[model samples]
Structure formats: C-alpha cells, structure tokens
Target: MSPEYAIEGAFSIKSDVYGFGVLMIEIVTGKKNRFFTHPDHNLNLLGHTWKSYNEDRLSELIDASILESSDQDEVFRVIAIGLLCVQQYPEDRPTMSSVMKMLTSNITLPRPKQPGFFTERKLEEADTSHSMLCLSSSNHSITTLAPR
Candidate 1:
C-alpha cells in the first residue's frame, strides 16, 4: 500500500465498520447511503437514521418502499448494529471482528444507543486527479489528496 493507503489501512478495520453501518442504513431505508433528503428534515439519511434511533422510533427509518418484504426483527438488529458502528468515538465502535460476531453469532450484542451525524459529501470542490491520495470514513471516501 502507498503511504496514503497505509494510513487508511491503519484505520481500515474501523472504516469497514463504518461502511457496514452505511450498508445497514441503506438496507433499512431502501435508499442509497449517500445524499438522502427527507421531506420533514434537511438532514441526510444518516442524520435521519440517527434521529430515529435516538427517538426510540428506529422502525420509522424503515423504507416504506420495501416494508412488507422486510423482517422486523432482523431489520431492527441491523439498525442497532449500524448505530453501533457509527458511534462518534472509535473506541466505542465495534471492530470488524466483533461486528462479524454480532452479525453471524447468537451472542447478545450490546445495545447501541445512537449514531453521530454522518458528514455530508462535498463533491463539487473535490479534485479528480489527487482524489486517490486518501481514504476517509466520513463523506464519500474519494481518493482526494485531502487528509484521510
């Protein structure tokens, strides 16, 4: 790995954890993980997911588009898992090892309280050439020369 990738690799496990969080959010909401807009709130899907989790109405974050096809228990579990990954403190978040255990095993995973806000994407100002210089868990991890 390049020095930049090496840096990101240092954080790779945590980054994968974050990606899992976004994936779970996408699965529950039937929306892309990036740039979601809700009618009532200006916050993106991550924000909405965080709000729903915090408000004890995480079920509300489930997308109406696929409601009937979803399993409520599994959905809730995934939501909780997502929130766990998105915790603001890296230490509070599960490592991929723990995440895999949480997903596959019957062990009782810790309850996830709530997720912090996901940083917004700012593609307009992004530099196409040097985008590969870094990897980021926040925003879209464009390979920009910006700090990872």
Candidate 2:
C-alpha cells in the first residue's frame, strides 16, 4: 500500500497478490506471515514456506491445527492460488475474479514462478530497507516531540 511500490494511482493488483499470499499462509499455518518466525533462521512464515517448497517439502507448510478443518485437495488448491498471487511478475498474477474461480472450480492453475522476496536473503534485505527509513523518521519525530 505504500507509495514506494505503487504501480498506478493506488496500490495495484500486485498488492492484492501480496495479500492473497498472506491469506494463504495464514489459512494453512493458522499463523500470520508477518509475525510468524521459523525456528531455524528466524524467517517469517512466507520465507519458511518458500524454503520448504524449494526443498520439495510442500506438506511442511501445512499446520496441524488445520488438519481436521482443511480438505487435502482444497488445501493444495489454495496453496497454488497463493503462489499465483505472489508471483514476481505482476502480469503473471491472476485477478481477483480469476482467483475466485481458481479456488472454487477444478480448473488447472498455471505454475507460479519464484516469488519476489521468496528467499531469506532477499527478505532480510527487503525488511531492512522497509524499516530503515521508517525507523529513522520515527527517531526524528521522537527528538522533535521531546523537550529540547
């Protein structure tokens, strides 16, 4: 939603893609990707899923809590939809309408490419960049707000 990444007048379809990916992760893991951390590298849920997927361990992305609530076929379908939402190229991502159909129907989905910020290394860099400016501005605000 930040202007830094805006494609047009407002946050574009790609932004929705990011949101869909987050929702998918949340649905599978019963966890929020923003705050979920991995035991190994302290990576967030998205990074953890990407790592697992890369290693051909897709089932690892699923949460035990959802085992009863989730249908295996539906789970796989949603996972594929999520991956489509997070594709690096905006053009490759499906619109919300397409996403809805993909989720509800038995349509064959396109394979998703490596997602943006999929790797821990890339995610770390993105996290650093995203926070650096905000932190610096907040510090400045604190100094200005305090008695001099």
Candidate 3:
C-alpha cells in the first residue's frame, strides 16, 4: 500500500502509480516489497533502492539472475523510473504518461525523492499513535474503507 493511503486516507491515480512502482521494483529485484531485508539497514526495498541509487551502487539492487541476462543500462533505467513513480508526495511522482515517455525515450529523468513508507518503524509509530487517539475518543467503533 502507498503511504498516503495507509496514513492519510488519500487515494487517487497517484496511488496506482505508486503500486506500479512497487511492482516494478519487485520484478527488477526479485524481492517482495514487504519482505525485503538488508543486514546493514532497516529500509524497505524502495528506501534501499533510493540509497543505492544515490550512492552509485544501483547495480547491486538488481537480482543476480537479471543482471546476468539483462542489459545493465536498461535495468538501471527501469529502476530509476520505478523510483520516480514512488516518490513521497503524489505531486512529486510522475504521471503514468510521463513515466511511459521516460521509459520509452532517451529523455533525461528527474532524480527521485525519498519514497513513501520508507521505513516500517515510522509506519508502526503512526499506526500506534492513531490507535491511541481512537481509543481516547468517544467514537470507538467507526471504521472506514479506503478506496482501491
């Protein structure tokens, strides 16, 4: 789930864009976004990818099998596009059409900002606080469904 959907109850075309980004990252890395792990950091796949990209270690983010078979530059471009779709704010993320252009053309892609839901701990904290606020309020049974 995108951070805005989980934390702020906001959903839009941008949310689908975020989901697409996560899917692309999973395909490129051969790892599930929810289960990604690195011994050296607490970041999720998106956070790790962003860090790797910034540190010039993006090649390390790809799956070994993909690395052996795929063109490195193309893989990097896909990863960059994925990161672009998952930026923290909807406004920061590219439109789907823009993403397509970036993927298909040689146009220069903008650098990605930090991704939504970058750390599990931060999400947990937000959920905890929200639960506490709910409990303290008079209305304790209200539930709302987020639009998919």
Alpha-carbon local distance difference test for all models: 0.67, 0.68, 0.86
Where does model 3 exceed 4 Å of error? 120-148
Model 1 per-residue lDDT tens digits across residues 55-85: 8787777887656787777777788888888
Question: How much is 61 displaced in model 3, in angstroms?
Answer: 1.1
Q: Model 2: which ten-residue window has the lowest total lDDT?
A: 1-10
| Model number with the top TM-score | 3
Q: After superposition, how far is residue 63 of candidate 2 from its true place, in Å?
A: 1.8
Candidates 1 and 2 compared: the better one by lDDT is: 2
lDDT of 2 by residue, 1-148 (tens): 2121533345565677667776876788777765565657866566676676668676677887676677866786677688777766677778888988897899998877766555454556647855775678643543334332
Cα displacement (Å) at residue 13, model 3 = 1.8
Provide the clashing-pair count of each candidate structure. 3, 0, 0
25-141 in candidate 3: lDDT tens per residue?
A: 999999987757677876878888888989999888999999999999999999999998998899899999998899889999888888888774455654576577657877556
Clashes of 1: 3
For every model shown, what is its TM-score relative to the native structure?
0.65, 0.68, 0.79
Ten contiguous residues minimizing lDDT sum, candidate 3: 120-129
In angstroms, the error of model 3 at 9 is: 1.4
